[model samples]
Structure formats: structure tokens, C-alpha cells
Target: MKKIAQFFLKPTVPVVTINGQITEKSVIELEKNLKDIRVSTAKALAVVVNSPGGSPTQSKKMVDLIHNFAHDNHLTVYTFAEDLAASAGFQVLISGDKVFADQQSTLGSIGSITNFMNVKELILNQGIEIRSVTTNPASVTNQSMFKDVPEELRHVYENMLQSQHKKFIDLVEEQRGSKIKVPKEKRGSLLYNGDVFNGKQALEYGLIDSIGRVQDVMKEEFPKADVVFPQKPSISGKFMEYAKLYNLFQTIYQK
Candidate 1:
């Protein structure tokens, strides 16, 4: 019976969901599940995304993995922007062999951001002994969030962000290839100045193939293949928030 079931059953097209803000832990779970599909009975993969985006570095890492999987394994990869695929979400979306967006989906925001709080006065008033210790001057300049950040440190950080943004543009251009048609407003700014667009605008800018649904996308790629979604790995969402807050406090208060 098992053999008959196996023999008669059709191949499945797995759908991987990328919802919420992307994070390192989330990407780890995504990669592990993707690898399972890569080795399982799935023939094609459809990625359904509804995200406002997150860390650029993490998004780029995911893009490389997805693109490599499709390229090296000779498989079809489709990415569907459900509602929102902004910033880092769009970065990952372009890696697919075919990318689509829902009619009302939002896209774009090609930029990077960093937040730092200068607590020098707060510590001085509290008489806190915040010892700034580091072996390397460069590391101190870049990582040490003590007092006000120096102009040199700001320059270095800005340069780092600019480099990442350029890489993003290059990747999008390579993937879309003469399809990008961003309006004048979205252009002529540092990192495209994090501009956003609706699905129609995104498609005009060659950011997506068409406005479509995940089910339709799967049917286009796999015809009558059954849908197979990998079991989502357990990730403690609330715990991660607490851990992140704790880490931020440590960075701010630790001597």
C-alpha cells in the first residue's frame, strides 16, 4: 500500500512563507526548511512573502541561498509578494527565477538604517563608571557606542551602508535586466532614499513579473503538482523580543 501510494502520488510544489520582520533566527528556520524541500519529493518551490523587511545582511544571505538552490539544482523558484515586500524583503524577492506581486502589494525601500542612543549625559549624571576598552582603534571607532560617535566613525559607518546599497542595486539590475524603470522621484538620492511603490509601480520599475497570487504562481510553475509545505520550525517570537531587548541593554550599560 505504501509503495502504491508512493508510485501513484504526484510530485508536490512546496510553498515557503516569509511573513513578519526578517531576523537571523527567522532566516535560520527558513533556510533549514528550504533545505528539507530541496531534498524531499518537491519539484518546484513557491515563496509567499508579506514582510515590511528587516536586516539587509540577513536578507542578502537568504537571497544567495535561494538563487544558488535554483541555479545549482536546476529547479523553478517563484516568489510572490502578497501584501508587503519592502526593503530587505524585496532584496530576497529578486533572487527568484520568477517574481510576482499582488495587485495591491507594496514594494521597494532600497536603503539601510542604524539607530544609536548617546547616553553620555545619562551615565555622567548617574556616576556610572563606563570604561571604554578595546584592543583595536578601528574596532573602537566602529563598535563602541560610548559617548557621542565621532565624525570619523560616522563616515566609516555611512560608507559601509552605501556599499551595501550599491550591491543591492547591482543585484536588482542583474536580475531584472533593462526592465527597471524607476521614476525620476525614486532616483537621484542616497540609497534610492528608501522609496516605496505600489504593485503597479513596482512592476513598472521591473521589480516584479506580474500581479498574481501564490496559488496561481504555483499552478503556472508546476501545473497539477500537489502543494507540500514543510513543517514550520518552532521559534519563540516573544522570547526573541525579550532577548533582543536584553542584548540592547547590555550593549548600552555593560562596562
Candidate 2:
């Protein structure tokens, strides 16, 4: 009787994996997969994320894409943070209607960062000098890696980072809302100060809805639905994977 019921239901849930850095190429591929899912008979979408986070702009696009798809199709978005989901990755994680993570998964690190290096001394030691002329030398002078950032220019950078940081905080507050345990006034000093939490702690802080593997949680959330994951790699892809492993082993033995 149960088997007959399952056969008649025919529920399917399409899964999308967002791995590694969130770059232009990865975002484009994600959009393509979502487009395919948009037309499918599936009623829900599962996103598996394992990323240390990269490219804030790309991450924004990814979050927007998933949110738009969920809204348009009226499908539930289930996100699972595997291994690591920090910074921009966490931004994407919150896009899900329900989020899950492994007990040891690393999450959070909500903040903005910009790095600059002044190589003037290093080049000077090598007795090499680089010179260029531009229409607005004063405006571009402190912005160059060869020159130290002036106090005024530093303020500009700080303002930019603050703007970005505020955006991240707003998104979190909008999604998690009362789920966040941190007090309102102290949320800035506590939650949004670029700190990472393990899955257990993340659950306590209400960053994730639950702590479970994607497969297990999907079964519990949508029991009758058949979870359809992405296709396996082609023959050439498998060969490349093996070749990469072989190279790693050779390097390790040599070392």
C-alpha cells in the first residue's frame, strides 16, 4: 500500500550545488540550472553550499537569483551549508526558506574587507622604478599599490566598507529577524563583527534552521518527494579528477 502511494505521488525535488568561490562563471552556471528547475514539475529546490566566500557582487546576484526563483515558482528553498559557509556564502545560505548544516559545519563571518599592499620599498630594494602619467594623478596617487594610502583616501575606503557591512547586516536582520539571539543594539558588536560559528553554535544563534545532512533533512521535510541531484561527471571529467589526485600524490611523495 505504501509503495503504491509512493508510485502515485511522483514528487520530485531538484537539487543545485553551489561549491567553491562564487565567481561570474559559477553564478552563470547556477542561473542556468535554476532556469531548468523553473520549468520542472518539482515543487521545491535544494541548494547545497560549500564555499569560503568570494566576490560580494556575485554573491548578491546568486542570492537574488534564488530568491526570485522561489518567489516566481512559489517553491520552497532549502539550503544546506556543508563544510564551510562564511561571509558571502552565509549571505547566500540565508536565502533558503529552511537552512540546514552539518554538526561541524563552519558558518558566519558576516563583514566586508578590502586589502591594499604598498610595494614601494620592495621595488626600491631591487633598484627598479615604475612611473606612469594620468590625467588625474592626485586622485589616483594614493590608490596605487606603489604609494601609501593617504589619510583622506583611507576615510574613503572605510566609508565604502561600512556601507557594504551595513548591507550585509540589513540582509541578515531582514531574513533571520527575531531568530537572531543577539540583542538589537549589540547585534553590531556581536553578530555582524566578522565572527564564524560552528553548526551547533549557528543553530543556537539561529543562523540555521537545523543541523542535518541534506539527504536526511530533505527526506524529513518532503518525505514523499524524490530528491534529484545534479548529474554525475562525464568520462573525461572522471579522468581529470583522477589525474589531479595522481598529481597531488606525486607532489606529496616528492615533498
Candidate 3:
């Protein structure tokens, strides 16, 4: 009881938590922490994540930062996704020098999704009109899409998603090239069409290095490290809504 009390009273190892949706701001903060030479003091750096994913742009920025930080600081970095880490979140999870996850954790969604609503009819029904000013046909092609979206617009948008998806695939291949193998038939596609998996599947797919809790793994790897929380990812739904709304309007409407 006395030793347990002492353990509670002591400061633990520094474990940075990247636990929410990946956004520009999230990447900014994470990069800031990584840039901190303070990480050099820790025996090993650990990142814990649980997210449904967000912007691909932010995911790439974060993945780059993770790579750069570990290399520059020579700190062994460990990443974890507990419960869930899909889409952009999965990209970040695999960025770890070594990745971990809970046995039942959901992982992977190595694809891009740009969801939108065709509300032009709804607005017209209410007698509301959205006027726009644009310079050219290409410019208006995107902004004029609040209602009936065109096949051309859909095609272009799909191209954009494919472009981003290609990058996602490239990153996975780069990070876990040796550990993962895609059956010949599934090449040029996600591990399973944006479907997430349990830890065992993730490990088999080479999405993670192992399946274990941060505390247990860190205790064994960095016994004397000062475990602390540099920061944590805030789990929320507002960012996902914003991504869809902003991307939809930006790609489909011009004004």
C-alpha cells in the first residue's frame, strides 16, 4: 500500500497523446512538441492515438514531422491507437518508428472521403437563391454545386480523392514496406476499402508494430523514463463536419 501510494505520488514517463481528429492545428501542436529538444531527455517517446481521422493534408504533415523528429533527435518513437484510428488517423499511427494498439482496437481506412450534400433543391424549395461571382467556367464549376452536381464535377472530385488516396498508399508502403504485403489482387486499393480492423488484423497487415498498452510496453522498454503527458488529442465530431462542409463548398461552388 505504501509503495502504491508512492507510485501515485510520483511523476510518470512523458507519453504524448495524439488522440483526436487530425487537423492543421493538431499537426501544428504535435510538430511543436516534436521540435522540442526536451524529448531528448526521455528514454523513448510514446504517442497514443484514437481517432476516426480527418484531413489528408494534415496527416501528411504529421507523418513527416514524426519521421523528422525521430531522426533528428534519435529518439525511439512508439505510437498507439486505442479503440479506433481510421483514415488520416491510421496514417499517423503508422508513422511511428514502432506502432502499437489494443487487441480490439479498430485500425486502418487508408483512403480519402469527401462527402457532400446536394441541397440545391432544399434551398430552392424554400425560395432561397445563392448568387455567385466567378471569373471562368472552371472557377464556377466547383462553387455552383450546392444543388444539382454535374457528372464532370463528380469526376473531378473523384480524381482529387484518388490523388490523395495514392499518397496515403505511398506513405503506408514507405513506412511499413518490409512488414506489410498486399496480395497481388488488392494492389492499388485500400487494405479493405476503408474498412477498419481489430489489432490482430492490423498487425497482420503491418499497420502496427505490436498490440499492447502504452504503460505496459513503456514500463518494459523505458523503465527509468519520466512518463508525462506533453499533450493529448481531443476527440470531437465538429472537425469532421467542417472538413465535409468546407471541402464540399470549395470544390463544388465558386462564390
TM-score of each: 0.74, 0.82, 0.77
Root-mean-square deviation of Cα positions for candidate 3 versus the true structure, in angstroms:
16.2
| Per-residue C-alpha lDDT of model 3 across residues 116-183, encoded as one tens digit per residue | 76788888889999876655534324545465665666777888888887887788888887788567
TM-score winner: 2
Expressed as tens digits, the lDDT of each residue in 1-255 for candidate 2 is 333323333667889989998899989999888876523346588999999999889999999998898888778899999999998899899889988999999999999888998998998899988786666544634378876777777877889899999999999999997788767988778788999999999998888898888788778878887788755457896587557656766887899
Model 3 lDDT on a 0 to 1 scale: 0.73
Where model 1 places Cα greater than 4 Å from the true spot, the runs are 1-7, 38-41, 127-146, 183-191, 220-223, 231-255
Backbone clash pairs for candidate 1 read: none
lDDT (tens digit, per residue) of candidate 1 on 37-143? 62334676788878898987788778777777767756689888988888889887877877898878888887777777787888788988677666654553445
Error of 2 at 155 (Å): 1.6
For model 2 the TM-score comes to 0.82
Tally clashes: model 3.
15
TM-score, predicted candidate 3 vs. hidden true structure: 0.77
